[model samples]
Target chain A: MAISGGAKGILIFAALALLALALAGFITGAIGAAFVDKFSGDENVVHGWTGDVLPLDQPAVHLAPQYVFGDHAGDSLDYDNKEAKKYDDSSKIFNDNSFVITNTILSSLVTSGVLIFLFVLGTARMSVVPGRLQGLLESLVEGLLGFIESVMGAGKGRGVFPLIATIFLFVAFNAWLALIPIYQSFGVIEDGHLKATFLRPAGTDLNMPLALALISFFFVEILGIRAHGIGYFGEFFRFGNLLRGRILTGLIDVFVGLLEGISHLVRVVSFTFRLFGNMTAGEILLLVSSFLVAFLFSVPFYGLELLVGLIQAVIFAGLTVVFAAIAVAPHEAEEH
Target chain B: MADLGFHWPSLLVFLVNFGILLAVLYYFGYKRILAMLDQRSASIRDSLSEADRVRQESTQAREELEAQLGEARRAGQQVLEEARQAAERYREEEQARARAEAEDFLRRARTQIEQERNQAIEQVREHFADLAITAAERVIDRSLDRDAHRDLIERALSESAEAQRN
Candidate 1:
């Protein structure tokens, strides 16, 4: 709590410097310049160069990741220009093209590499008495396994842990990595504005979340079928009572079964959009904050995005565990 | 859906990427670490049980050693007590034998002294009678019958012996 005179002076000086930088960033940024042009009555002074220099172009939100390399990188540039034109006129139709190496794909590869490298380093010289990195890795694994076991029960939990933990870590790391300043800084620049970056968060891409959703969907259905045999489908198609001459109750059961079947399929769409929407919204929020104030303002949003990433990851993995548990449980045990 | 970037190829790629990651992480990270943990715990349990066994064995051995030492000490005391009693009995028997021999020698010495004193008294009586007869004869200047003197001395000695006997 106590600071020396010299240290106190240095601290005060640092705070003042940061305040000055934030104020300067605001004045030259998009909102502050619009006010300056309006009040100072000088259109030529600040507005001319600031518009060209500050990347003041509205953020282009394409649901797909732009290609940064490979054969489709040239087509990706054309597609970027088309997307940019749509923001100005609102009548242009967007062209969709499949590319070999998109920025999001690159980001996912980087995330995977980092995870593997960390694991290799932690487990290279493992012993009963662990060093710091080994200890950290061990505790992370144990904590994740403990949480999962608490949800799914101990014996069944370990059976599904690898898949659950991988999904959680991958999604969480992808979001966190995008929060780094360099991810948005350098990119393929066209027409004095940014087009595509070398990296983007994998979660932002529609395909990434779609892939995860499909994986989760299949895993859940397969587990159910394996657990209950053909009877798992009986939960969705209940015509058995109608065959036995209970007309009223059979109709109700049949209708409820129909609803259940639709809802089970709807899970895929819900899972996909939930992650993609959150990730895309976060990315856009960061872009808009920087466009509005340019500096010191997006820092808080970065913290918000960090919490969002963790929550989304936990939700994704936790839901999967719950679904798996439901799948494996005896559905008709209570009826008996 | 196309506007949302739903390409089949890209989704397939993502699936493959995830599959590879899962395989590597499961094999390299989770399996080995769990195995090592189980091994460490098992070894620790074995060591603890081994230590308990050694402590019990040492305690039992110490008790046995103490019991043996007590038994030896009691045996030694019993031998020493018997030796002491035997020595006391030998000393009493030797004392009794030495006292009986000394009493027997004292009785034999008393009988020999009585016989020597009686003999000396008889010799002294014979010499005294001879001297008296010689002196009477010298005064009378006549020869006295030797046989008569002798007879007279013998008769007097016989009567003295009879009186001493009575």
Candidate 2:
């Protein structure tokens, strides 16, 4: 019963959170656009040092040379302005700072890769008398598996654990990645002081979650087909029952199928936006809160940001599981 | 609005990142951890079954030993009782034989005494007879008279001859 309740709560909370996050993403994007426009003129001004150009017609430039590189001529020479040009061009393509090799990307890749590796290794060695690492991984997976099985009714949950676990790891790593001071130093020189800038969180970047969501959508349909065969395809058209006596039920089934398809499409959008909004909002909130009190008074909000990061990660993964479960469930089997 | 350009390298990097993550998880986390867990569970089960087998064998051996001991004790008691009975029977038979032998010796001694007594009586009788004969002969010689003395001698000589022949 606890398992069922937890599954239900996770599903419901994840769905609601995803919707809220989508709305928030839209709002933040709009607000951020406005904020950027409002503050565009207040860009920090720095002493730009120019040196010899490479064959690619790129000039070596350095910003706040004392902070990034010590006051050494060799350090200034080492700065590759071509890398900056590449970043500048990529940033233009995304219409945001997403394509740049920002701190968020590095942290996300490192943290997620490390965590997934450890978890998989631990699970591979799973035992009743497991070693410390294996035991921890087993317990975590078992808890999730038990919860999913209880809700989806045993045997029904196993097919989706891999997807769910992947989503969990990805979102968790990305969420935590956003918390680091990745964007705290990103800036463009306009006036005199160093003003901070931000790049989109890894999961918030649409491409990541969209790719995941599309994969989930494809598999869900595939599983339904495999489970029910051509009859599953009949869900979309479903005219045979109409030729028989059950016209109303057939129509209802068709309508429901259409609605389900629409929801599947919306899930991709929602899943992407949800992760994006949560991470972005947390990042923005931390930035703004810290700005309000300089730095000292914003310490407590960092704790809040950490909590939010964890919750958002859990919410994203939980929703992915729920969707995957619904997609693969033998709901059509009941009709038969 | 400034047009943003596409960079292929960043996209490639992203793909690479995803690939690496998937590979690492597949190799390190999934394979190794699951194998370890299976190994641990198997070992635990093996230990438990081994212990159970040993326990059963020990119990069986103890029961067999107890049964053998009980049989040995019963056999020992039987042997002890048999020896005691045999000793008692032998003692009784020897005692009965000794009592019979003692009775036979007493009867023989009685018979011998009777024979001796009879022999002595016979001897005594013979001597008396002889003495009487001698006395009569002496009287007749001394007094020698005629016809009356001759008759007394004849009678005494006949009596003495008869006693000597007996």
How far does residue B36 in candidate 2 sit from its true spot (Å)?
1.3
Per-candidate local distance difference test = 0.78, 0.56
Taking the tens digit of each residue's C-alpha lDDT, what string does model 1 give over A81-146? Answer: 456553221112222333367788889999988888887788888898888987887887787888
Evaluate model 1 with DockQ and give the value.
0.27
Model 1 chain A poorest ten-residue lDDT run: A86-95
TM-score of 1: 0.74
How far in Å is the alpha carbon of A63 misplaced in model 2?
25
Question: Model 1: residues >4 Å from true position, as ranges?
Answer: A38-55, A70-99, A332-336, B51-166
Please report the TM-score between candidate 2 and the true structure.
Answer: 0.59
Looking at model 2, residue B3 earns an lDDT score of 15
lDDT of 1 by residue, B120-163 (tens): 77765675566456555553664558886676556655655664
Please give the lDDT score at residue A181 for candidate 2: 65
